[model samples]
Target: MGRSLVRHPGVRGCYTAGNKRFLQLNELDELRMDVYENVKLYKEWTKQWHDSKITRKEIIVGDKVLLFNSRFQLFPRNLRSRWSGPFEVVTVFPYGSFELKNNKGECLKVNGHRVKYFYEGQPIQARGELELEDLPSLWDE
Candidate 1:
């Protein structure tokens, strides 16, 4: 009689509950897989965007460049500049490396990423000079 009651159509069976639990577990697994794929795609997009923003430095042998000063100094001043050199590029190596010559004739090999091209000054524009006699004086009025 008990077996018959358990197997009755109106009564909730153990096998039915087990089947529902198994289905729920499968749904959770599918959702987890989807999240993993989305995270991977996001990482790939971030890497691509970062790579696009990077500018390639074209360094030549004779160009003047400033080297980054990365050395740790004690009691560093707040207004001090971090770049140390207006060094001349003596040689450019194959893979983003450079040989630099300082003003004291000291040669140092450093990575190209640490150096930037230095601009001395802008070209001076020529204009006609005006004398004080040709200028209008506000005091005369």
Candidate 2:
């Protein structure tokens, strides 16, 4: 005792794997199977999952981080390229954004997503000949 299939132009029967069957409970079974599959797939997708990530959340202002430089523009015909380098975190704004200073010591403000962070940050030194003592020694400083 199940409901009938949705009427087709020229049929009063049901379709299984391929062929037509006359008045079986096929439609009801198919509906039940589809509902069960959908529920199963949703549960599997929403189950708990683990991912490797840095657990620390104490990045404060004045910390140094490395930014990423990529040529691809998010907007069409964007004039300036997204530039990145060792920048000092100058000020943390209200939201998840911070003011940054570039390698030349110029102040520029940017959002969090636009700049990436480095765990072991390095100080920016001038190009050409940078001697060992000229750069801030990581261990010593």
Q: Which prediction has the highest lDDT against the true structure?
A: 1
**lDDT per residue as tens, model 2, 7-115:** 5557555344333453345787888999999999887766633223333344579788666565565664567545556689999887667788877889987767666
Give the per-residue lDDT of model 1 (tens digit) for 1-141.
122222447666644555667668879999999999999999999999999999999889899999998888899998989998799999999999999999999999998888999988888999999899998999999
lDDT scores of the candidates, listed in order: 0.88, 0.68
Off by over 4 Å in 1: 1-8, 11-19, 122-141
Backbone clash pairs for candidate 2 read none
Quote the positional error of residue 136 for candidate 1 in Å: 20
Model 1 earns a TM-score of: 0.71
Worst 10 residues of 2 by lDDT: 48-57
TM-score of 2: 0.42
Model 1 pairs in collision: none
Any idea what lDDT model 1 has? 0.88
